[model samples]
Target: MPHYFLDYQDSFHDLVDVDGRELDNDEHAATAARSMLAGRACLEILRGADAVISVRVRRGPTPLFSVTLAITEDRFHLNG
Candidate 1:
């Protein structure tokens, strides 16, 4: 198992994961990151904060993947 850090990134700064977790593979790490990003608590955060909040998937100091909740605005409606 390899250690993966799910770091939280905002516009101003990044909140590093001091105690990272050891996962089975990259897919597992990515799944965890997505879950953290799209959780119900995060939705509440999105409602209040204007800046985009993203999850940075990293192995040691190297980044593997990055994802965030994207809000699309149009005349008709929106999509995530």
Candidate 2:
């Protein structure tokens, strides 16, 4: 199983597991999980904000196997 972390503005917000169906295989699962995690992270940041600035992916401890999702907001630009 793989773990995912959602960060907002460099702050931890939520964590979740990526569904197996969303991925092609265990390896891809990790990648999709990380991407979804990033989306979730960005959503968290834009939940109440007026606009999204940016979204980013941060490689975690398991860069080769694991990853982190980060979201950033600046003015009216959102990057992911």
Candidate 3:
């Protein structure tokens, strides 16, 4: 199986800090991460037939966060 990377903006960056409250607070970071992960999981399942997919969140140049899903196929074929 091939590996893929997903990049997205992080809205919780402000909430996550060295103070440890972000991790300790069940209603905050944990909840957000779970929701994001769940969405990614669903996408993976849907794309399983064609390719293996991975989802990741990353911060972009813009202020908003973007969610990226990468799909990698096992074989490569060039056809015009």
Question: Which tens-of-lDDT digit does each residue in 2-55 have in candidate 3?
Answer: 112223232222222222222333234434444665675566556554432222
Mark the 10 consecutive residues where model 1 has the least summed lDDT. Answer: 69-78
> Can you give the TM-score per candidate against the true fold?
0.71, 0.33, 0.31
Measured on C-alpha atoms, candidate 1 has an lDDT of 0.80
Q: What is candidate 1's lDDT per residue for 1-36, written digit by digit as tens? A: 999999986666679998999999999999999898
Q: Candidate 2: lDDT of 38? A: 64
lDDT of each: 0.80, 0.42, 0.37
Q: For each candidate, how many residue pairs have backbone atoms clashing (under 3 Å)?
A: 0, 7, 6
Judge candidate 2 against the unseen true structure and give its global Cα lDDT, from 0 to 1: 0.42
Model 2 per-residue lDDT tens digits across residues 20-69: 23333455545564665566655666675443222222233332344444
Question: Model 3: runs farther than 4 Å from truth?
Answer: 1-26, 49-80
Ranking the candidates on lDDT from highest down gives 1, 2, 3
Error of 3 at 65 (Å): 19
User: Which ranges in model 1 have alpha carbons more than 4 Å from their true place?
Assistant: 11-13, 40-49, 71-80
The total number of steric clashes, by the backbone 3 Å criterion, in model 1 comes to 0
Best by lDDT: 1
lDDT of 3 at 44: 55
